[model samples]
Target: MSDDGRIATDGIAERECGEPQREPPCEFCHIAAGDEPAARLYADEQTVAFLDRQPAVTGHTLIVPRAHEGELFHLDAAATAAVFETVQTMTDALEAALEPDGFSVFYTSGPLVGTVEHAHVHLVPRFEDDSVSLALSRRRLGESDASELVSAIREYC
Candidate 1:
């Protein structure tokens, strides 16, 4: 039995995420911990899905890991899986409920790209002629540039 739209988990989220909890408490963490108000759609041991308070489009939902990882790359394998699983679930639910022509699912990793420090995935229901634009600037890189980029990224992996 759960209140506040949170799905019941059998306390499986007791495992530590290894990331130091933020001092001021991230807003998403508050939402996940049920200490803040949110239109919660779903919750599991590791993740929570809720309607975005400041939505880019109708039915905009956010899938967030219950543990506070400030960025996507900071998430460990289990948290990553749980976050994406919730993303897929929320996308399906949004598609069925809103019946939009398409959808935009995205994540911004850093403070420069993302507004909030907590890592989360945004699923926005897109309709035809919607004003929202998720488009990024297009660029064609030279062969050497592209090859160098790939090599540089692969070095870290």
Candidate 2:
């Protein structure tokens, strides 16, 4: 990858993205061949879970194996273990980070959902009032009940 966060450019640069600086997905396998964008949460090269750009709810994170997969358990036991381990860590963090009433975790595979064409787990946070609440590190929790949960959230963050 280039210092600019893209694969080193060749003459293949095109105006399809409406800006010369915007590289098309077709030009890179990571976005096209690999079937999706890079992750927001990455540890070494084992796995990543990033907030979905088109989220069902704010703080909705997508967890997946670093290796592109069409099925969940297609991964070797060790690799599968790694992805799930990160999923647990992320779940605890999201609960505290978003302070939602509760949260849910699910995954879709095969050609049916075809989510970005890769098998990925969805970490959707459920709130009591059904309003959008982001798990922003910048904002402090409000209300005594919510504030009390912050410590618990911090434990996992």
Candidate 3:
């Protein structure tokens, strides 16, 4: 580990503050572990926030738990709360700095919907006419279909 508490993984050199010297198996884990570089915004014992490289908007950011949790379901309650707390702080900062019309906070839990396996909450700043849509087209469910879906969900709950 370097003076900044970042580990030099493989042959990747330790950086003072720029981009990561090497890519790790889990990008978010690497960033949180201080093994990879990111445009870090906030960090605590349990979580970290950083800018999204392929941002949906100017202030697009990701808040994640420092631990390597592949899905939101994998996080303990404290870890989940830590991640959201960072999300709240970053959202406020984004609003103050960018003056966006609105903002969005979302998470994808599984491989089917999530790009990264690491549990993360996306904080996307929105503006009028931004041409971004988080909307999914609505489809009416038949009574039987709705009942079946509800039953399936309730089983897990």
Q: Quick one: best lDDT, which candidate? A: 3
Using lDDT as the yardstick, the better of models 1 and 3 is 3
Clashing residue pairs for model 3: none
The list of candidate 1 runs beyond 4 A from truth reads 1-21
Per-residue CA lDDT of model 3 for 56-127, tens digit only, reads: 889899998887777865788988888888888998899899999989889976778888877889999999
Best by TM-score: 1
Determine which window of 10 residues in candidate 3 has minimal summed lDDT.
Answer: 16-25
- Estimate candidate 1's alpha-carbon lDDT, on a 0 to 1 scale: 0.82
Cα displacement (Å) at residue 115, model 2: 2.8
For model 2, residues 52-74, the per-residue Cα lDDT tens digits are 77888778887767665567788
lDDT of each: 0.82, 0.65, 0.84
- The best-first sequence of candidates by TM-score reads 1, 3, 2
Give residue 45's error in model 3 in angstroms.
0.6
TM-scores vs. true structure, each candidate: 0.82, 0.57, 0.77
Give the poorly placed runs of model 2, Cα more than 4 Å off.
Answer: 1-39, 131-157
Q: Which runs of model 3 end up more than 4 angstroms from their true locations?
A: 1-24
